[model samples]
Target chain A: MSGREAILGNIRKGLKRSGPLAGTALELCQTRLREHRPNLIPARAQLPHAGQVELFVQMAQEASATVARVTERAAVPAEVARYLADIGFAAEAIVAPDASIAGLDWSAAGVATEARHARNGDRATVAPAFAGIAETGTLMLLAGPQSPTTLNFLPDAHIVVLDAARIVGPYEDAWAMLRSERGEGWMPRVVNWITGPSRSADIEQKLQMGAHGPIRLHIVLIGD
Target chain B: MQITSPRFKQNAHEALGDAALQRALGNLKAGFPGKRAAAVARMPEFEQLRDAARDLKNHILEHLDFYLETFEANVKRRGGHVHWARDAEEARAIVLDICRKAGAKTVTKGKSMITEEIGLNDHLAANGIEPIETDLGEYIIQLRGEHPSHIIAPAIHVNLDQVSDAFHAHHGKYGKTERQTEPRALMNEAREILRDKFIAADVGITGANFCIAETGTTVIVTNEGNGDLTQTLPRVHVAVTSIEKVVPTLEDATLLHRLLSRSATGQEIEVYGTWSSGPRRPEDPDGPAEYHVVLLDNGRSNMLGNEFREMLRCIRCSACMNHCPVYGAIGGHAYGWVYPGPMGSVLTPAFIGVEQAGNLPNASTFCGRCESVCPVRIPLPKLMRHWRAREFEKHLTPQGFRFGLGVWAWLARRPKLYRLATQVATRVLKPLGGKTNRIGSLPLAGGWTAWRDLPAPQGRTFFEQWKDRQQAGGAK
Candidate 1:
């Protein structure tokens, strides 16, 4: 028999063995579905509008949060160099890379940026996502030719550059767009949708951001 | 590991006494449920989405076989292998054989409860294959030689100082030059140390959040992106998931996804929602060369026909645990199993013997909080009652407790006699009442009075008061 047939056979045997209450249990499952509905935040509201992004930047500035901006078409190498210089990230700090970041002058950038690598050092290079969700202020990165998964994590301060035009309304829209783009047969093994930095409330309920993930999230939204 | 029900009380006592554990548990108590509430409040349609998700799960469970078949076919069409394991032994054997065939020296794993259930790491280790847990929480627990304390937050019982010590002790042996106390420094140390393992590991293993039947995809949601790396970089990717994880279509999966993140960490979604269908095709530039999915039954199939089948609807968001007062006080490790909290209390007996887990069901205060907070509304307190009934049927209750309950039931059945006896007893005990108007001790009620005093009863019982009111009305 085919592998599918084997798996089904196993499932059938399991159901049969689970005994009499299985039917009632399943019915109860249906009842629960009818009863307790959990709330879900819509994806559209999660994204910040163009006006909201401006206000957000202003708010960040007012709050004394370090903010940086980079233009999309500018040479990535030079832009990365300027970003590092401004942030005072040493040239020798470890770097992370997203696969989408291509044709960059790594040596000229003067920072040791590893491609598709997760290292412990302070410096890293990553491909910025297209848009940041204003509601959660999340950076969504599709794992494809241009973006690598490593750069989003494995750094103290994460610097991401985004193409403002590529922003979408919600996570579902991104998924729908991804399905349309990739089609039925081929799906990327990993699509990382990141929000803010790594955080944990594991210590006395204190909101300690960046527990095991990036401590600082720097987004460079490139205007058209 | 042999985890006993008695160990729960012991472990809880030890945990309560430890300042570090108390600190860690305090963080979880304040953070997870609070975030979930805020996230829920933000969305007007959150309840609707949860209902849809729950309905979708129920529908899928009804035709689980059909969906599993579709999923398996899709996976094969995409060049992935699917293995069927009827029980834990079969599951472990299948994984070990795969490792042996691949000549794998090292395996990097994402957090998989199924793997824990089947003892995959132990199996691999016994066979001389090193299985490395890459999730920081899992890694910490592994280094400390302990099981996961909580389902989602594995190292919930561990504090930063303990983590620092674990890192200092372990990383030093692995060539780490520094002992760091700060959280950032420790995280960096782990990242640096694990990076090489990720790059060099021959196989990657992960647990599935949801398995879609329509597209034949297994989805994993994670915050750290470790699961993504584990699935992508390795030459071989193996997914170990329970059979109940299957959903009919991407739409159904999406419905569940809406509830999963909100219930889990109060986020709209986790940092990463990865879908891996199969191995890489010719056009793909990067991915695992081979993909395999092991669908494990391991006593879940039996649950399908049982009253406890609703347990299968668990999305593992841990909402019930987050809200349970008993779970909150004792924490996950005290439950002493792969699953913990209300879910574990119901599940452990089913997986192991009911006789061995008698204490688990009785552990609850029956506050009904678990049932209320459950995203799927499992009615956990009722399930515990069912277990208690079963325990009684099996004559598992102690002889003395049984006799006490029998005498109490007899007295409760005859109101007049019970009232007279109570009245006489109250008059005799009135002299013993202290200045606090409390009885400090009683012969048969030492258990109640040991930790607290019993309030002195009023002279008249409810029945006597009611009779007096009736006589006055008649006379008037």
Candidate 2:
């Protein structure tokens, strides 16, 4: 027998099922998979939209990411430039190829941009988040042509822009939105939920930031 | 990877006397447990979530075959390969076979306990492939040619000066001759050195916290972004995880994800939680060209049917170890395997034989703190007792221990005789108590009195005191 069948056979024997589930058991399994219902949503995640954005900012800041609110999409370039200047960095960043980011006139705000995946020694990468989660102040970025996975991890500074309208109160809401956008059972190659800059406490249990990812995480919130 | 668990008592005895390990363990006791307590305090629904997490795993275990099959089919749909290994040897062969097919020269690895369980790196190196551990903790231990002492913190046994010595000795090739004592400077050195390997490695291997059956996705939660780079930067990505890691859906994976980091390191969430479905899509700019999942079932399938079935619910959170008083005292190396602490005590006996690891379950104090802090509520103490029973039945325990147990059982059988003996003993030993009412040492119980003074017994036994109180018409 194949290794797959042999292992499954042992599992079946262990669970006391001679074979696969049938009738009600099979139906119940299928229904549960299809439904994909969440177990229990934390009450802290059940907030209004404005409240969620507020909580998102608060939590993101707590996780050591700097948050800046911009009134409109056109204001993102200026905000990015300002953050770079404040950090004493160059005003050039590797921007994601996402249309929302590509269409922005970065030079108008005195910032130079290379719209592609990040490479070694890249100082920063500005990308658009699919959604901002309020519960943990996390940014959900799906991998695709517009959003390259490398742009998130290969740079020292990660500058993310998320529309306030795209913020959700819980992770389940973000996942549900993804299922609805890309049909059920269809998942992106990668779904990244980034809470803050990378960190590790491996050295004497003392945490140090920028452990193989962005040292500074700058979130440009595109609304009040 | 050798089962030194047979010498657990000796190893623990030596660990208690090692000053460097003691200092490191001192830092560990103050780190993770306090953070977990604070994290739990903030989340009012944390207990409910743990119950839900445990039930979710139980449901999956009952329907393990269906969920695993579904997971495989989903991975195939996403253009990824799923390989099953019945044991450690097969798991190693399967991984090496994939590396050979990929023509891999050097492989960069994310921290994976399963690979350590299968001894994958040694297998790959024997076949002329270099495996680089990317996690800071795993990397330090790897440099010392050591296995992980702790699951989450692999180098928890190594101190700062030791890291400095290792780096100073090995980093000359990379033009770093001076020893870096500061954690930040040392971390940056590793980052620079590993950056080249991540960019150049042919295959990247990682462990999965959860394998979602609904979408055929494998989720890896890491505070360091190294797991992401390990999977994304290589030409081939292989996720090595066990059979029990498969969950029914992403929602279920998220529910457990909420509990894992909080329990492991007291973070609300790990900095990076990445879900990889398959290889990169044609439209993607950068990611692995091929994706694979190596699913192993070394002894966990057997655990599903036995009294230790609850052990499969473990998320490798390290909470059980951090809160374990025994683990705090001796550190992880005393357990002498890939795993340690309460979870390791139960798992080591099952992974190896009860005979080889008979001393592990005996190492516990039955403090019940591990189970109390366990997010999945594994009943670790009960499982250890089960192992102790099996050891006694198999005659694996020492002759002296068995004889002592027999005499104690005989004495316990007769209540009157037990009371009489205890009263006589207390009266005989009463004068030995000094001004402090504590015995400095005793002839037969030297082992107990070696480290600290033993509290002296009062003149009367509890039975006599209870009878006197009853005669005087006590409140009870």
Best by DockQ: 2
lDDT tens digits by residue: candidate 1, B1-476: 65756566677677678776777778788778888998788667776776766666676666677667668888988889989887788899999988888889999999888898888898899999999998888898899998887888888888888888889889887888577887757766777788778888999999998987766889998876678768877889999998899976555676777678888778766766677778876645567889999998777766776777777888888888888888888788777777888888998888876787877888888998777767666778888888888888899988988999899899999988898888897777776776767898988899779757888876666777898999999999
lDDT of 2 by residue, B1-476 (tens): 67788889899999999999999998899999999999999999999999999999989988989999999999999899999999999999999999999999999999999999999999999999999999999999889999998999999989888999888888999999999998999999999999999999999999999999999999999988999999999999999999999999989999999999999999999999999999988989999999999999999999998888999999899999999999999988899887899999999989888988888899888989999999998999999999999999999888988998999899999998999899999988888987888998999788888888878888999888998999889755
How big an interface RMSD has model 1?
A: 5.5
DockQ of each: 0.26, 0.89
Query: How high is the CA lDDT of each candidate model?
Result: 0.72, 0.93
Candidate 2: tens digits of C-alpha lDDT, residues A9-98: 888899898898788999999999999998899999999899999999999999999999989999999999999999989999999998
Q: Residues A1-224, candidate 1: write the lDDT tens digits.
A: 74335556555665663322347754664444333232354643454567546644543333223456666545555666676777677663333344335545568767565555444453555565745544344556655445545565656677676666655554455555555676734456455656655654433334455545566666666763
TM-score of 1: 0.83
The true-versus-predicted C-alpha distance at residue A70 of model 2, in Å, is 0.1
TM-score of chain A of each: 0.63, 0.98
State the TM-score for model 2: 0.98
- In candidate 1, residue B352 scores what lDDT? 77
Q: Lowest lDDT 10-mer window, candidate 2 chain B?
A: B467-476
